[model samples]
Target: MKKHQWMATLLSLICTGLGMFYIGTPGMIIGGMLLMALQGAALFIFFMTLGYLGLIIGPLAIGIHIIGLIIPVLYFSYRSPRKPMFDEKRRRQLSSPWKIVVRTIIGLALFAGSIYAGYTWGSAPFMKTAAEKREVQEAAESYLEQKYNEPFKVTDVDYTWAIGSYNLTAHPEKAPELEFTLSSNDASPPAISNDTYLNQLWGQQLRDRLKPLLDELYPDQAFGEAYVFAGSDTVERDYSRLANNADGDVSQNVRLIVFADLTADNLAQEKERVLELIRRLPSVTVPGETDLTIDYYAADLKTPESVKKVEQDIDDMKGKTSTYSFRVFDISDITSADDIEIRGLE
Candidate 1:
């Protein structure tokens, strides 16, 4: 074999160009290195095209070397098949470099076009849908404030639509109206009479017991009509009713529902009263299992000043009863009277 050919083969085998240096073809050495880079890129693309299993690695290795060898050989054949090898031939006598540059530019332009199209056409609608949710929440909150003379700092909201499947021959003109449905925790319907009445009574009794406890804890705050639910079914029903927007055929939209209300001017006093009530309310004690952290006693007491007193009362109660804990959420800013207008069928 020719000295340059022998060197090219060795360098291509070792990773292109190392053997070319031994043969003394500076031009062929550069071409061999370029071939090696192209071979590596082809192997990577091949793996990506396949499911990326290691099975393709063998074929990729063979294919890459073959292409690398053929390209340089073809270039040499065209340049000077009769040249007495390396030192006599100039490296720059090979193929045009401008072609490679043009192809690279085209590839980059295609990639950028795809990215722009995906952003504008494929992904923009989903972003708009997400933004719509925030707008719906704000609108629902505003509506509640206007309707009930109270601001509903809506803590939560959700919606679900009715589904339908039509037959192949279904009339296209008879399409149903697109309806909106709003659901929330506060708008849950009340349970059947027998399922929750007894528990309701128990809840009231617990509240009665708590009234005196609150009085003892904070003498300044007066306890108002405290609503309590004993059974989970009723509570669940009420919560669901509060959350669901049963109005209109769609029965879905935004539900700015209210859970509790305290008709008192002293927001701080009411908060303290509620907190004391929560702390004093009796709970079903389960031995050796602290996982059942029962804090069912909650009152939506509004106003910052009264809220402080409520916190102080909780601290005092904790000192007296170390085993108990409570979740004091602020529903004070929510006093919406806007009823969740229910459908007759619902």
Candidate 2:
């Protein structure tokens, strides 16, 4: 077929470098194929990285499209190819404008199909369809109602790629903050992303018990963050869900992290007090192996950022930056207390 200029221009306009395909010259054909390969690679990378590569790939793809747009315009107007598009034998095919339009339509349809295929392959694993989302929501709702005896609504299902699970946001009908953070793999019951449910099972009671013991010891400073861990096991997400009955969370093995402020003068005394509190933990919760750490920080550097600055300042200040103020410690797997290690006191 004798390729027309307008058909070449139209194809390039919509399908990018595809116009070069119609130009029927060796250089143009090869250039069009190269552009096609580049565009395909860009699209695949964009999908695999979850669209993180869009900033770079987007501009490169558009630049290729612009080249496709200009190729036909420049060639037809300037005789830039300087060669006939088709030989006598090749020109025997259809030259009808209707047939040309039909060919263009077919090319466009194929291009669109390729795009849809790429999207399905790249994103389907990372997102849930409407029916799948609803299924996750229903599973979470049923699990919560049966376990907690409270009406819970599934608000949203977010696919967390890092953990490889679809985390469903389920909240009590009354309070949005009480999220159950239920997650599902579609093959089985959903796991919890947080401990709101476990708090009811035992975490809350433990928290309530720990607070009073710390109050008696320091009587003023509040706890920072608290965790109840099972003996030598660290998996926390599978604990209390009715469908998962994982007994790791039900174990009495626990650890406590406390923050305190003290100077060289009272460091030893405070350590003994914290150890006494750990000894008293048996009265409040079930007995099992435990780890207790008192993070001693300078009293004045209470904010996390400030304490972090001082912790890092030792390279320049030779450990003097937090000598008078700060917290202690990360003692683990213990019957606990601290030994006197006060320096720079004199």
Q: Using lDDT as the measure, which candidate wins?
A: 2
Give the TM-scores of the predictions, in the order they appear: 0.23, 0.50
Cα error, residue 197 of model 2, in Å, equals 1.7
Return the TM-score for candidate 1, rounded to 2 decimals.
Answer: 0.23
The local lDDT score (0 to 100) that residue 170 gets in candidate 1 is 10
Q: What lDDT, from 0 to 1, does candidate 1 have?
A: 0.35
Report the C-alpha displacement of residue 149, candidate 2, in angstroms: 2.1
Task: Tell me how candidate 2 scores on lDDT.
Answer: 0.57
State each model's CA lDDT, in order. Answer: 0.35, 0.57
Give the lDDT of residue 92 in candidate 1.
33
> Where does candidate 1 have its weakest 10-residue lDDT segment?
164-173
- Each prediction's total of clashing residue pairs, residues at least 3 apart in sequence or on different chains, is 26, 12
The alpha-carbon root-mean-square deviation between model 1 and the true structure, to one decimal in Å, is 19.1
lDDT (Cα, tens digit) per residue for candidate 2, span 12-59:
987866677666555666676666656666676778898888999899
User: In candidate 1, how many Å is residue 210 off?
Assistant: 11
